[model samples]
Target: MLDPELVERITARRAELDELEEQLAEQLAEVRAERDELAVAERVLERIARQLAE
Candidate 1:
């Protein structure tokens, strides 16, 4: 059987990893949202430049 203390430590570490995963997921979502916004801004600029060229 595994030592009780070892098991407890493993459980704590797992919880910590779970929290880190949640934080990383949140950050990834924010990055994706910013990227999408930048893409939209780029498109708008392109359209403006085309209009000005004509």
Candidate 2:
């Protein structure tokens, strides 16, 4: 059987990892949203450039 203290330490580490994962997921979502917004802006600029070129 695993030592009780070892098991407790493992559980604590797992919780810490879970919290980090949650934080990273939130950050990733924000980055993706910003990327999408930039993509839209890029498209608008491209459209304007095409018209200006004509």
Candidate 3:
């Protein structure tokens, strides 16, 4: 069994870990949005190229 002080420290550290996880999730969401925008831009460029070729 752990001591009381150690248990308290672990509890506090867990909260910090949770906060960090939330921050990471937000950043991942932003990255995914940017990736989707890039994909749309790529499709537009391809269409323009096909028009020029004809």
Candidate 4:
């Protein structure tokens, strides 16, 4: 059987990992949103440039 202290340590580590995972997920979402916005801006800029060149 596992010792009580070891079990407690395992539980604590799991909680810490869960919190870290949540934080990383949120950051990933923010990064994706920024990337999408940049892509849209790039498209607009290209369109304007083409219009000006014509």
Candidate 5:
């Protein structure tokens, strides 16, 4: 038998944590997209250099 106030507090904290988790997930996705874009740029540069060498 839990106190109603305590249960309410716990529920509030869980919601806050859920929001933070969603924000972190979004940030992670942004970082991964940036990394992928950089990788693609590097490959393009390498290909251009190789073409100039021929």
Candidate 6:
């Protein structure tokens, strides 16, 4: 069995961890969006190069 103080501390720490997890998820989503945009740009560049070659 845990003491009251320890239980309170654990609860606080869990809340902090949850907030950090949310922040990390938002950052990951931004990174994924940037990566997807880059991929599209790469495909467009490749198409332009092929057109130029022909």
lDDT values, one for every candidate: 1.00, 0.99, 0.99, 1.00, 1.00, 0.99
Evaluated at residue 3, the lDDT of candidate 1 is: 100
Per-residue lDDT of candidate 1, residues 1-54 (tens digit): 889999999999999999999999999999999999999999999999999999
Q: Which is the winner by lDDT between candidate 5 and candidate 6? A: 5
lDDT of 3 by residue, 1-54 (tens): 779999999999999999999999999999999999999999999999999999
Off by over 4 Å in 5: none
In TM-score terms, candidate 3 sits at: 0.87
**lDDT at residue 42 of model 1 (Cα atoms):** 100
TM-score of each: 0.97, 0.89, 0.87, 0.97, 0.90, 0.91
1-54, model 4: which lDDT tens digit per residue? 999999999999999999999999999999999999999999999999999999
Ranking by TM-score: 1, 4, 6, 5, 2, 3
lDDT value, residue 19 of candidate 2: 100
For model 4, how big is the CA root-mean-square deviation? 0.5
Over 1-54, each residue of candidate 6 has an lDDT whose tens digit, in order, gives: 779999999999999999999999999999999999999999999999999999
Candidate 6 contains a number of clashing pairs equal to: 0
Q: Which of candidates 3 and 5 reaches a greater TM-score?
A: 5
Q: For candidate 5, report its TM-score.
A: 0.90
Lowest summed lDDT across 10 adjacent residues in model 2 is found at: 1-10
Candidate 4 has a TM-score of: 0.97
